[model samples]
Target: MTDRSFLDWPFFEAKHRAWADEVEAWAAAHAARLTDEHDADGSTRALAAAMGEAGLLRAACPADGKLDVRMLCLARDILARHSGLADFAFAMQGLGTGAITLFGCEPARDFLADVRAGRALAAFALSEPEAGSDVAALATTATRDGADWVLNGEKTWISNGGIAGGYVVFARSGEAPGAKGLTAFWVPGGLVRVVERIEVSAPHPLARLAFDDVRIPDSHRIGAAGDGFKVAMATLDVFRATVGAAALGFARRGLDLTVERATSRKLFGAPLFDQQMTQGAIADSAVEVDASALLVYRAAWLKDQGTPRVSREASMAKLHATEAAFRIADRCAQLHGGLGVVRDAAPEVLTREVRALRVYEGASEIQRIVIARAETAR
Candidate 1:
């Protein structure tokens, strides 16, 4: 079980504690089935639907038709600790539907209603073959027609790429080149074609999509013509801290598994936990987990207080937590020796899941750049 002492901190309220407990209980009951890597799309979609049915997804959206970043962070931390797939399911629900919550018009809001109820699976389509962290380099184009817009381009590494019911696509409007020319649109599925679904080490379903003369009504546009950059940034800003929360969850589980194995295994005719080296490793894991929790919750608390932006804090949390999770998982795997490398070990699963967190959202290198730029600007 995770340390409940953090709940006593002033950063969290009674309601937050209650919500965390509920999510933790739900996860304990569901994580086992979702752990199967086979049929990842089926597992993820089922988990998403179950999360929605439990009313937990309601917390993902706010009453003002926006998202509360703090709640998102809390939920991700709780769920990820229990199951990575559960965290993936919940995080995608918010990320895929973020533009709609932040900048969607009346019609867009209506479309998002399906998302809130889990009737629609949504996706964010911003990264292209050439643009990952550098949003300014996106080459997807959207040209205006009589009463519609024609979109053409390819988006790669999109989460829920093949399974999403619809996508919030970002494309250049030709108004101006680079970031200024960008616009966001709500494009329903089947309009765009899935070119390829990339298989990676982790075994989650990700794909590359191609928009060949895809026509969407002007009404599908999310914000102003040149406001795509702002919309994307706003959405990412709200959920950025939650990425750290997810990493923390993975770390906590890795630590727990390590501790359990250490206490049970024997070395030198004594329990492995009795060794000084084992004790030191356990202490290090505990300290890192606490440090990560502090950083992640601090970012969430700041955002919930209505801070305009938290780029510095969010980058710090994502960088530190994700890096820490990788280290914690690696150390745990090492402690497990030959058995750790086996797929069935809990620590091995954590090792695989945590490996990808460092690359997604923004890579560790990109987070460092964000942090350095923010510090210098200050």
Candidate 2:
């Protein structure tokens, strides 16, 4: 069990606590199916359907267009404690439809409805081969036609790339130089072709997408023209902290596994816990887990309290928690000896699951840059 005491922190409300309990209870009953090692796409699709049926995905994009960051964090933290695929399914629903929730026209809003219901998958296509961290250098082009925008470019590292029902694509519109010259579109999956499927340590429906002169009606545009950068950043801003929450969950689970092994596994004619080295490892893991929870929840609380933008806080949370979670997971594997290296073992699974959280959304190095820039600006 995770340290549920975090629920009592003043950062959460009675409602947030209730939501967490609800998700936790639901996960306790249904986690086996969602967590099993099925094919990546099959399992992800199954998770989407199951979570949607449970009404767990409704919070991802609410009808009122008001996102409760705390609720999002709580759900991700709890679900991630159970399984990373569960967290991925839930987070993508929010992230994939985030722009539509905030700035969708009627057609895009309809798509958001299906995503929230888990009838379809959603994806955010913002990165290109040459423009991973540099949003300004995006080369995808969106040219104006009479009633449509012709899109042409390649997007790599797109989550739900082939499986998603629709994508929120950012393309350069030449509104101005660099970051200013961009537009966002809600392109249906029918117009896309998968260029390549990306296989990562943790399997997911990741792929490279090629948009060859695909056309979306002007009505599918999100935010103002040339505001694509803002839309992408805003969407990322809301969910960045939740990335840390997921990391916290992974770390907490690792700590629990470590504790169980240390107290029961024998070494040198005594429990492994009797070893000074093992005791020190346990103590450090506990400290990192708690510190990560504080940072993760603090960022969520700041966003929920209506901080205009929480880039700095969110970046700090992502940077520290992800970095700490990886370290803690590695330690979990280390303490488990050779069993940790065995495929499908708890420690090995967890170690693989968490390796990507640091790189996706925003890389740790990018988080550092975001923090440093914010501080220097302050």
lDDT of 1 by residue, 1-378 (tens): 567788888898878888888888888888666666877798888887887778778777444675667678888998888878788888888888888888865656755666667666778899999999999899999999999999999999998898888899999996777788899999887787999999877767799999999998999999999889989988888788899999998999989888988988999898999988889998999999999989999998998888999988998999999999999998899889988899856778889989999888889999999999998999
True-vs-predicted CA distance for residue 254, candidate 1, Å:
0.7
* lDDT against the true structure, each candidate: 0.86, 0.90
Worst 10 residues of 1 by lDDT: 61-70
Clashes of each: 0, 0
Instruction: Tell me each candidate's TM-score.
Output: 0.97, 0.98
Taking all chains together, the TM-score of candidate 1 against the true structure is 0.97
- Model 1 Cα shift for residue 120 (angstroms): 2.0
Q: Write the per-residue lDDT of candidate 2 for residues 1-378, one digit (tens) a residue.
A: 567897898898899998998999987887656765657788788888888888888889787788998898888888888888888889999998888887776787777778878899999999999999899999999999999899999999999999999999999999999999999999999899999999888878899999998988999899999999999999999999999989998998899999999999999899999999999998999999888888888988988888989999999999999999999999999999999999989999999999999998899999999999999999
Best by lDDT: 2
